[model samples]
Every structure is written in structure tokens, then in C-alpha cells.
Target: MKIVVLNGSPDSRRFELDCYLAELEGLLETRGHVVKSFELRAMNIGHCTGCWGCWVKTPGECVIRDDSQKVCRAAINSDLLLFASPVIMGFTSAVLKKISDRLIPLLHPYFEIDRGEIHHRKRYERYPAVGLLLERATDTDEEDLELIRDIYARMALDFKSELKFTGLTGNPAEEAADALDRL
Candidate 1:
């Protein structure tokens, strides 16, 4: 399988989340899967303007000539998308949210009464599985994990992918290694 791992943490290689992703990458590679990792922090990604230019003006092309479109292309070609991030206030990092927002161009838009709603019905077929790694602080509340699970659930529904969550609280390295083994 060709896998694309998106590191949502802004700290890139310095963050604990990277340890998790690295372990997973090694596991996948050992299993004869080609892995390509993208760190959201290092890429020059811009915020989505909600212009719908990608859908209306140039189909499948984003107006923003940034690294995000490149990531989107990789995602389209990948067999699995591994999304990793550090839990921040019971949610994904801002970097991941920005990436997700910019990915709006990958979705279809339907207009109704001058309002456009994104239709992601076709996006699911490209990638059937998603592996999520979340690193929570030691002091983080259990409710935070619940909130993260809820968010992942919604993401799974939208992408039509089987969402697997590996929660690494405090001991990211060990937990990540175990998670990779389980995967």
C-alpha cells in the first residue's frame, strides 16, 4: 500500500507526535508499503478563502499556488492517509485544521439558494482507510479524548474511512510503537 502520513503538529520533527508517525512509517515500510510523510508545519500552506475557484474556475486546481495542493494530489494518489497531531484543547492542532480547510477544493460544491455546500461523496473512494494518532498531555482530561474521538468519528463519516485512533498520553514513543504493532 502507498501511504501518505500527514503530520498535523507544527513542531514537525521536534514534537512527540512525530515519534508516533515515525514508528508507524517504519511498520508500514517493513510490511512492504511505500510511505510518504508530509509535515504540515514545514509546508507553505495558506488558508482557504472559500472562493470555490477550484471547483468553478479551474476544476481540480486550487487558486492558491502553495504546498497544500501538492499534498492534496499526494492524498488522491495514496492508498491510506495517516493523520497525526497533538491534542490541543481537545482538538487537532491549528495546522491540521488549516490543511483540512484547504482541502475543501478536493470536495464538490452544490449550490442551493446562493449557498454552497461541500459534497464529499466522491472523496471517500480514493482512500478507504485512515489511521489517526493523537498525543495527549499527562494532565489532559479524559473528556478531551472523548472530544477527539467525536471529531474523528465525524471525519470518518465524511471521508467514509475506517478511523483507528491511537491515544498516546504522556508516553508518546512507547504508545506509538505499540500502536504501530497493533496496526
Candidate 2:
């Protein structure tokens, strides 16, 4: 599988998630899967101004000139797109959210009914399946994780893809990769 890992850790150098992702990358490579990753904080990603430029002025591309374009391309092309982040205030870090919001360019402005709910039309022929790799907070509970998963599940629907799984950094990286391999 061709996997693109969006490392949403705010501190790439200090976070243990970085090490865990590295191990997971190595394991995936051993299985002959192409693995690529992006350190979101290190890149020049900007906030989404909700200008709708990507949907109106320029279809399928954002007006902001930043590293998010690279992220969008990688995400659109990959077989699996892993969103990895440390839980901050019961959610993913701000940097990750910034990029995630900027990903609006990849969806069309039109809406459709999916499971009796309105959703955006897909802009791409195929969207990569999404996986969540979260690092829990000190006071993290099961509810927080479920909330995160539920939100990402809706996000998967927006992209016309599946929510593969939501794993944690505390778990062995090998196990995470093995889960993907099985899929």
C-alpha cells in the first residue's frame, strides 16, 4: 500500500509520537509498502480563511501558497492517509487542524444526501482511506477517543472513503502497521 502519514504533532522533536511513527514507517517498508510522511509543523501551512477560493476561483486548488498544497496532493494520491496527532484540549493540535481545514479545497462546493444527511460532492475520483493515530492526553478518557473517531468517521464520508481505524501512540507501532497490512 502507498501510505502518506500526516504527522500532526506540534513538537516533532519532542513528541514520542514521532518515534512511534518512525517505527511504524519502518515496519510498513519491511512489508514492501511505500510510506511517505509530512511533519506538519515544520511545513509552512496557513489557516483556512474560508474564502472558498479552492471551490470557486480555482477548483480543486487552494489560493493560499503554502505547504498544504503538498499535503493535499499526497493525501489525494495515497492509498491510506494517516492523521497522527497528540490530543490537545480533547482534539488534535492546532497545526493539524489548520491543515485539515485547508483540505477543503479537495471537496466540491455542491452538496448531496448521504445516509439522509447533506454532504459535499467528491472532487477526486478516488479518496484515500483515513486512519487516526492519536496520542492521548493525561486526562484522556474513552469518550474523548470515541468523539474523535466519530468526527473522523464523518470526515471519511465527506471524502467518500473509509475510516480504517483509530490507534494510539502507546500501542506498538508494529501492531498498527500489521493492522493496515491485514486490510
Candidate 3:
């Protein structure tokens, strides 16, 4: 399996989330899965300006020529796309959200009925299964986790995929790897 990890933790120092991802990456690689991780803080990725240019002028591509293009390509080509971040103020970091918003180019401008709800059509024939790996802050609670999960589930649906896994840094990396292997 090929996996792409979008590391949205903004802190440069040694953080818990980064450590968890390092271990997870190693385990996955050892298990014969190719892993590609994009450290969002280190990359040059601009915020999505809500310009319909990606949908109109340039179909299936973001008009903004930035590192997000690499991210979009890796995400669309991966078997699993994992969103890893530290929960800040009860949600994922802003950097993660920024890149997440930029992923809109992967979908077509047209809408299609899916599960009785209107969703954008897929620009690609297949999209990666989505997963969430969160490092909880001191103030994080169950409600926050649930809300994040709900949002990502909807995001997966919008991407024409499914949310395959959700794990926390509190768990061992081996546990997370095992869960991913099951997927």
C-alpha cells in the first residue's frame, strides 16, 4: 500500500505528533508500504482563495502554483491519505485546514447525488481513503474528537472516498500501524 501523510503540525520543535508520525512511518515502511509525508510548515503552501479558477479555467488543478500541487497529486495517487496534526483550540491546526481547502481541485465543478445528498463529482477515477491522526491538546475533550471525526467523515465523502481510520498520538505507533494494516 502507498500512503501519503499530510503533517499539519506547525511547531518546529520536537513535538508529540511528529514523533508519533515518525514511528508510524517507519513501521509502515518496514511492513512494505511506501509512505510519503509532506511537512506543511516546511512547505510553501498558500491558502485557498475560493477562486473558481481551479474548476473553471484549469480543470482538476489548482490555479495557485504552490507546493499544494504536489500534495494534491500525492493524495490522489495514494491508497490512504492520512491527515496528522495536533489539536489546537479543539480543532486541527490552521495549516492543515489551509491545505485541506486547497484539495478542492481534485473534484469536478459538477454535483452528483450520493447517498441522497449532492456532492461534487470526482475529477479522478479514484481517491485515497482518508484517515485522521490527532495529537490531543491538554484541553481536548471527547466532544472535540467527535466533531473532528464528523467533519473528516464528511470530507471523505466529498472526496468520493471513505474515512478508514482515526487514531490518536496517545496510542502506541504499533497500534496505529496495526489499524492501518487492517485497512
Residue-level lDDT tens digits of model 1 in 1-183: 677878888774555677656766786677677889998898899998988898889877789899998898888787667677887777878998898787666555652221244435553346536667777765568888777777776676566455764455355445554554465
TM-score of each: 0.80, 0.97, 0.98
**Each prediction's whole-model lDDT (CA):** 0.71, 0.90, 0.95
Question: How big is the positional error of residue 37 in model 2, measured in Å on the Cα after superposition?
Answer: 0.3
Which of 1 and 3 is the better model by lDDT?
A: 3
Q: What is the lDDT of residue 55 in candidate 2?
A: 92
Best by TM-score: 3
Which of candidates 2 and 3 reaches a greater lDDT? 3
80-174 in candidate 2: lDDT tens per residue? Answer: 99999999888888888888999898899999898899999988899999999999889888899999999999888998888997899989888
lDDT (Cα, tens digit) per residue for candidate 3, span 72-118? 99999999999999999999999999999999999999999999999
Which regions in candidate 3 have their CA more than 4 angstroms from the true location?
none
lDDT of residue 1 for candidate 3 = 97
